[model samples]
Target: MYSTWPNLDTKTIHQQVLKWINERNNGLQSQN
Candidate 1:
């Protein structure tokens, strides 16, 4: 995995994942 990923730090990756999840949740909430 490190070979494929190379340079991203864990904090950056975690923030991106959290942002993605929040966007998805907001979309779902808006749909309801």
Candidate 2:
């Protein structure tokens, strides 16, 4: 059903946020 769509989008966003955080945590310059 349509319920799965939100879950997919949230997961993608979560991963991006994690990556951005990791870059910051590592003190690496990023354009995110």
Candidate 3:
């Protein structure tokens, strides 16, 4: 995810982290 997302700016990194975290959360919820 982060590998493909361009994180050259501070805001982009923050958004990417949130995006990655959300995906991880969704995956965990599906397992339950």
Q: TM-score: which candidate is best?
A: 1
After superposition, candidate 2 runs with Cα above 4 Å error: 1-8, 28-32
Q: For candidate 1, lDDT tens digit of each residue in 1-32?
A: 43455688777777888999999999999999
For candidate 1, what is the lDDT? Answer: 0.83
Clashes of each: 0, 0, 0
Residue-level lDDT for 20 in candidate 3: 100
Evaluated at residue 28, the lDDT of candidate 3 is 100
Candidate 2 per-residue lDDT, tens place, 1-32, comes to: 43656756767777878999997977755543
Please provide, for model 3 over 1-32, each residue's C-alpha lDDT reduced to its tens digit, 9 standing for 90 to 100: 45665646667888878999999999999999
Q: Which ten residues in a row have the lowest lDDT in candidate 2?
A: 1-10
Instruction: Tell how far residue 22 is off in model 1, in angstroms.
Output: 0.4
Error at 5, model 2, angstroms? 12
Full ranking by lDDT:
1, 3, 2
For candidate 3, give the lDDT: 0.83
